[model samples]
Target: MRVVIAGGHGKIALLLARSLTSAGDEVAALIRNPEHAADVRAAGAEPILFDVENTATDRLLAVVTGSDAVVFAAGAGQGSGVARKYTVDSGGSVRLAEAAEQVGTQRFLQISTMGAGQPPARGSDKVWAAYIDAKTQAENDLRARNLNWTILRPGRLIDTAGTGLVTLAPPPVGRGDVPRADVAAVLTALLPAAHTFGMTVELVSGSTPISQAIAQLSD
Candidate 1:
C-alpha cells in the first residue's frame, strides 16, 4: 500500500513511516522543512516538501495523488500561539481531508487528541486550549467527508519504548496516555480492515496485545 503522511517530521510520524517502510509498503511523507528530508529518507520514505499550513489545494492534491491513503498527522508545536493552533491543527486538517477527497484518495486517517470531543474546562490556562478546540473541529469536519475515514484519538503521547499494547473504543474510556510507537503500530494495523472505515475511535495503552488492540477498534 502507498501511504502519504502529513507532518512527516513529527516524532510519531517518523515512527509510523519506519514501520510502514519496514513492512514493504510505499511511503511518501509531506514535510515542511528541507532538513526533514534526510530524516524521512533515512526512515525509508520519500519526503515531499509541502507545508499543510501554507500549501495550495492543488499542491496538496498532487502529493496525495495515486496514493492509497492520506494521513493527517500535522500539528503546531507546543510553544506555538493559540491562533497558529487553529491554522495548523484545524484548518490544515480540514484542508487535507478536502484535498484527499478531491484527489480521489479513498482511505483517510487523522491523528487526533484524546480529549477532542469535550469542551475546555474553566480555569484552564494552557493558552493553547484553542489547539484542543481546533482539533475537535477538524475531526468533525473530516468525519463529514465522502472518503472512508478513521480518526484515532490517542492520549498523551510519550516517547518511551513501544510495548505494542493498546486499548481502543468509542471514546471517554480510552482516555489515558500511550507510547507514540504503539500508536504507530496500531495505525499500520488498521490499514487492511474494512470495519474501521467510517469510524472515529479513541485509543490508549492497555494490557491488550498489539493485534488485539487493533482488532478492538476495527471490530
Candidate 2:
C-alpha cells in the first residue's frame, strides 16, 4: 500500500511510519521541516516537505495523489500557544481530508484523542480542555468527509514498551492510557481491516492481549 502520513515527523507518526514501512508498505510522509527529511528517509519512507498550516490544498492533493491511504498524524507541539492547537490540530486535519478527497484517496486513518467528541468535565484544566476541543473539531471534520474514514481516539499516550495490549470502547471516564508502540501496532493492523472502515472507535490500553484487542476491533 502507498500510505501518506501527514505530520510524519511527529512522535507517534514516526513510529507508525516505521511500522508500516517495515511491513513492506510504501510510505510517504508529509513533513514541515526539511531538516527532518533525513530522519524520515532513515525510517525507510519518502518525505515531502510542506507546512500543514500554510500549504494549499492543490499542492497537498498532488502529494497524496495515487496513494492508497492517508493518515492525519500531525500535531502542534505542547509548547505552542492555544491558537496553534486549532490551526495544526483541527485546521490541518480538515485540509488533509479535503486534499485526500480531491485526490480520490478512499482510506483515511485519523489519529485523534480519547477526550475528543466529549465535553470536558466541569472545572477541568482550561488548557487541557482547549486541546481536546481542537482534536474534537478535527475528528468532526473528518467524519463529515466523503471517504472510508476510521477515527481512532486513544487515551493519554505513554511512551512505554510495546506490550501489544490494548482496550477499545466508547469514551471511558478513567481508563485512558496507551503506549506509543502499541498504538502504532494498532494502526498498522487496522490499515487493511474492513471491520474498522467508517468506524469511530475510542481506544486505550489495559491488560488485554494486543492480538486479542486487535482481533476484537477487526471483528
In model 2, the clashing pairs are: 164-210
TM-score of 2: 0.93
Cα lDDT of model 1 by residue, 17-127, tens digit:
999999999999999889879999999999999988887788887888899998888999878988888998999888888888888999999999888878877667665
Query: Across residues 1-219, which tens digit of lDDT does each residue of candidate 2 receive?
Result: 999999999878889989999989999999988999999998888999899999877788789899999999988877887889889999999988998898899999999987788898789877677788999999888878888988888888899888876787545535567898888888888788777777887778777776666568655
Candidate with top TM-score is: 1
RMSD of each: 1.3, 1.6
Q: Cα deviation of 35 in candidate 2 (Å)?
A: 1.5
Global CA lDDT of candidate 1, please?
0.86
Give the lowest summed-lDDT range of ten residues in model 1: 120-129
lDDT of each: 0.86, 0.85
| Number of the top lDDT candidate | 1
